[model samples]
Target chain A: MELYLTKNFGKPNAIAMAGYLKHGGYRALRKVLKKMEPKDVVEEVKDSGLRGRGGAGFPTGLKWSFMPQETDGPKYIACNADESEPGTFKDREFLEKEPQMMIEGLIISAYAMGVNTCYIYIRGEYATQTKILQQALAEAYEKKFLGRNILGSGFDCDIYVHRGAGAYICGEETGLMESIEGKKGQPRKKPPFPANFGLWGRPTTVNNVETFAQVPHIINKGASWFRGIGTEKSTGNTIFGVSGHVNKPGAYELPLGYGLKDLIYKDAGGIRNGRELKAVIPGGSSVKVLPADRIDVPLDHDSLTNAGSSLGTGAVIVMDDTTCMVRVGVVLAHFYRHESCGQCTNCREGSAWLHQLMVGIENGQGKIEDLDLLMDVADSLEGSSICALADAAAWPVQGLVTHFRDEFEEHIKTGKCTSPDSFRI
Target chain B: MLSENAKKEIEREMAKYPEKRAVILAALHLVQKEEGWISQDAMEEVASLLDLTPIEVREVTSFYTMFNMRPVGNHHLQVCTNLSCALMNGRGVVEYIQRKLGIEVGETTGDERFTLSTVECLGSCGTAPMMQIGDDYHENLSEPKIDSILETLK
Candidate 1:
């Protein structure tokens, strides 16, 4: 099937405004503005079953309906380009290569949600892609697609690029808003959510770059066609960033319900020299680890959720037999520990303690009972934070220790890492 | 002190936000681009310009990784030592960089030209064993490639 997300990827001048317009770029926005009412647009998306491509998988059209249509003050839309989840780099590819898709998507979405001001919260390290997006934005403004009275529709919307400093938690929607508000990238407690009170305390709708990019497609191609593309629940195509121990490790746009085994073996070129697949982090590092025996799950939200994992950000990090699961545990522990925002006691303390435990086990100072203690710490951290980060921090430890407790037990018993030094190049 | 161009850039970013306080990150980026690493003086200037306290700026500055707390070497070697890269010899690249520069992960060369440090991930995991040197990503690293890259640096 021709990829919806990456259709214009290899085409010349794909990122340029001219090239984008030539291939029917902002045609959806024009159609949405010229023809459909705001509510009708929302209805189309709700029927399409388009979910947020950023981790949570919330329905996009329903999220748009949450905006206060009769509110007096300004409304905002945040495009989450802060793609910092470990094993996920797909947003950068889309942002750099197909800038207009994001612009058009957000413009259409901004109009539908009654938002005149929008922000694209890009990750700090995306210096190159930021420039690419900036050029696209400038071109968008010059062509009267942005600014006052866009295309004589009497609607005005302006998009701004906000660069985030290197903080992983800021990828969380609330945390992202807080960072854009010039504070530490700490996540706010939910209740009065962003839809009601967000971005300087205004009604806001935040969606990922991928989610917004799909809006134009939904509008242009109709919701039914979009629904027909992916699996029933997880509609439409999504990008998967496949990395680690794969031969052709890169981002590939595939339908949502594509099999996990096919993603690893067929799409990513199968474990670098036909090596035996040992395990896989089905989503980003935050999702649970799946043992080699359970690689047949469809790469969609519901199927992966059923398999005790999430299709988060669609980042599939494959591991060959030569890859050490114990070391993988350590690396992820370090990441969570380093990224804990220090607001939540459980995440802040638990992530540190988990890392210490991993370090102790790696250095052969761990007690056998430390295995259970690791699980104990992970258990305590789950559902104990202001955001899902606490849960994210605890997942790898839980998944690895749950699936591979023998490995952790062996390390403590032998007082040494028994896994072969597979990566000591 | 922030330069004229930096101030102009900061002002341009400030106008985009509904709240001027929101431009703090953008202001920090402006300072870092002009001054290599954000200096104590630059923080105060940004805080003052944005109607923020230096402590507020410091709080944000300390929060993020890209905002270097100290002055960086002219060529900052940020290697990805996270899971995906580590599986592909990112650690070896770190070792090679340390051996080549005689500076451990967080140390700078005596010449102050190169600073080698290992970071979590730069999101180039697809092409593993990558390092970001002063905003440019050098991926698929090998011992000889590091040598040639270092040789080309001077």
Candidate 2:
């Protein structure tokens, strides 16, 4: 229940080494190097039940175990700072404000994984964050915490920042590695995943900025302490990035399995301007949305899944009654269509088709039969691509139509939107 | 086609990676940061510096949206109209900027001082109805805030 990830969020100079060290920043890294063996470090994380914060929710410890214990060449660790998921800005906080915590976590991860070289593949749109992170990296190196013979433990590690050039697809682990290799940021067909063949053909592991940031805490606090906080399955605290149509919207760090309704009504200070809550996208925009009535469900990976949604990135985007579901469909469809890497035909072409269909429906040219057609297209794009992007593109459309069928039908029948305060497309 | 400083920065970046191709994005970023955009000639220069074909460099540039294929105005105003932003009248922000700047979403002002663009999410969703003017984000935007931001830009 104690806050670890964002404890020093608004502290002045928290991004600097002095501020970070004042609050016991690199103590975990020192413990990791001086006391724990590589296997113990990995085992401790495994027992913590920490999942990937980058939306997939894969167990962090399991992911580290996949890296070969002994490698012939250098291994690499890529911290995915490419926080491009719509409605998600949790990782951006770590990158811009508490960067040292994330960097210390990264150094610990490198030590655990036997990685000497690492890269933080950040998105190019984060120009301010990139600068702050660069400064933090320099501070770590200057203090002998980053490069060669760290804390006299004879452990050598170097971290670099590789800025991505405005590609959302590059956030995918393989796409990220490809982007780091200076190639088109497209997800490669995975069989030889990053564990075996990755990053210029060296063994590599990619963890989210938030995921790596959790390691230092787990190492310092122990696994059982982390496990006792949240639900048995979903342990530890995560930053629930609450945005949109809320009275007090921002990132709130709370334990997993937090109530979705409380997140909207209590943590975010309820819906903005006394407007009635209409829908909630509990995860990033890619996850299926839940109607206001269904938000009584808990905010964890499994509970949301049982309710027919995924806890992707913990980005809760709320909508008031004034918002139009059809227009929401249009905007999200446009994002997927613009972001699809065009490698998969279903994703490339289907996302475009979905967007076109949504626009027609929004513009009052849709037919009632088009509703069925939209569902058909969404179904096809779900599992037919090389990556989950096609599924990501499909989920929002599916969630909107499934929950807001009456609205779509109303638009089709009346050739007009019913939402009184719907904005221009 | 690239400045000596940019070339030097790109070389330093190349040294960090095992292969030279890995620095192509950094190299292109360096050129675009200096010249306001990447030209075909500049792509060729970048390709040679990284031991890649001009088409290879061009392929990478064309794939990413951040690289300016053509020139932009002095200030690039990228407004976010994604879901969260849209809920807070993000589209209205775009329309307002369009009216204030006397340009469409993709057009530049005549004096070459400002260019207006409607971008996807830039991850500042907490402060919805926001725009990115170069590196810094103008969050919690309103007509008054936009006016103040524009005045400072000049």
Candidate 3:
């Protein structure tokens, strides 16, 4: 099937924009503004089985429905462009190539949620993306696609681009909201999700950049057509950012339930330099690892979950035999340790302890029982925080050590890494 | 109130917010752009400008890694040591800079040209072993690349 979303990548700027316009760019917003009620827009989105692309996989329509429907306070639609998950770079590419699509998505989502002002909280390091998006927003405003009385539909909305200061925790919805509000970006306690008390204690809906980008498509091609692309449970094409030990390592927008083997072998052109695949982090680094035997599993959210993993952000990190599993654990643990917002005790302390222990094992200083201790620490941090940042830190360690306990044991037994000579920690 | 220049820059940011205090962080960013780092006086000034308390300004400043509370060098080197970068020898790149500069993380060089800090992911995983010197991303870095980058900065 032809790729609709990323089809215009690398084309001439005007041609791309024209193509996007032809294939229903801002038509969804126009339709919503002219024909459908805001409530109906929300209902249609809820009917379309679109899920959050920022690792959580929550239903997009359900999330939009959470916003206070009758509130008179200023509401916000925040685009969670802080895609800082370890191996996720799809959103960055999407924004850099077709930023107007993302902007249109944001505007449509904002109008649906009754939000007049919106913010795209981009990662600070995405300098190119920020410039492109900001430029796109300007072009959009000049064309009356963004600012007041958009398209003469009597619906006024403004979208702003906010840059984050390179914090992974900011990828969380509440943290993104806090960061956009010019705060520290630590996650706040729940029971007041962003749908209720967000962006200055008013009602707000934080949706992932890709999730919002899908709105225009869903509206343009009716909800039934959108749902027909992927699977019954996991619908539509997802952009999988394939990296690590792969030949064609780039973002491929494929159907959701595409086979893992087909993704790696056929689409990615198999592993680089003819190396045998050892494991794959199907989602970003936060999800559980799957061994080579599970490569035949479909890459849908439900399938991966049943296979003891998640299709998180669609960042397929392929690992080969040359890689040391202990080193992978150590490297990922170090990230969680550094990125923890330190708002909650378990996450703040547990991530560091897990890192120290993983380092000890990788550096040949671990006892055999340290494996259990690593799991124990990860367990303590999981679900013990205000947001999923802690779990993002904890789950990978738990998965790595659980699936590759033999590698840790081998390291402890040999007092050194057992991988090939080039696999140095 | 903030200075005219600061206010103009902040007004652009405040336009993004429904409430003025929502742009407190942007105000602090503008203050840092002018003053190099956030001083207590600058925080107080920004608080008044955003109609927030000085404590609120201070809390916001201290919370984010990007905002420097005290003085820094003329240039700030933010090396990304997160997972993807680490897989590509990010740790080694950071160590090389520290040894060459003779200043540890969070310290300015003796010449006051650079302040090196290891940060979380910079979201450029494709170009692993990346560093952000100001707004520019120096990605796929090596020892030679690092030497050239530092030399140009100096």
Which is the leading candidate under lDDT? Answer: 2
Report the C-alpha lDDT of model 3 over A1-425, residue by residue, as the tens digit.
75877887777672245555765577777788889888888888888899888888899999888887788778888888888888888898678788778888888888788888888888866767787787788878877888888888888898888877657788888888878877788888887777888888888888888998888888888898888888898988989988777777778989889998999999989987898998999998899889888878999989999998999988888888887888888878888888788888898998899989989987889999998888888888888988887788888888888788888899999998898633343
For all the predictions, what are the DockQ values?
A: 0.73, 0.88, 0.45
Clashes of 3: 0
B3-95: candidate 3 lDDT, tens digit per residue: 798888887777666678777766776777777888999988888878888999898787777778889999999987766676666778888
lDDT of 2 by residue, A128-217 (tens): 999998998999999999888999999999999999999889999999999999999999998889999999888999999999888889
Worst 10 residues of 1 chain A by lDDT: A416-425
TM-score of chain B of 3: 0.93
Chain B TM-score for candidate 2: 0.98
- Compose the digit string of candidate 1's lDDT tens values, residues B33-84: 8888988999999999999899999999999999998988999999998888
| lDDT to native, each model | 0.90, 0.92, 0.83
DockQ winner between candidates 1 and 2: 2
Clashes of 1: 0
Taken in order, the candidates have interface RMSDs of 1.5, 0.8, 2.3
Candidate 2 chain A: 10-residue stretch with minimal lDDT? A416-425
Correct interface contacts retained, every candidate:
0.74, 0.89, 0.43
Model 3's TM-score against the true structure: 0.92
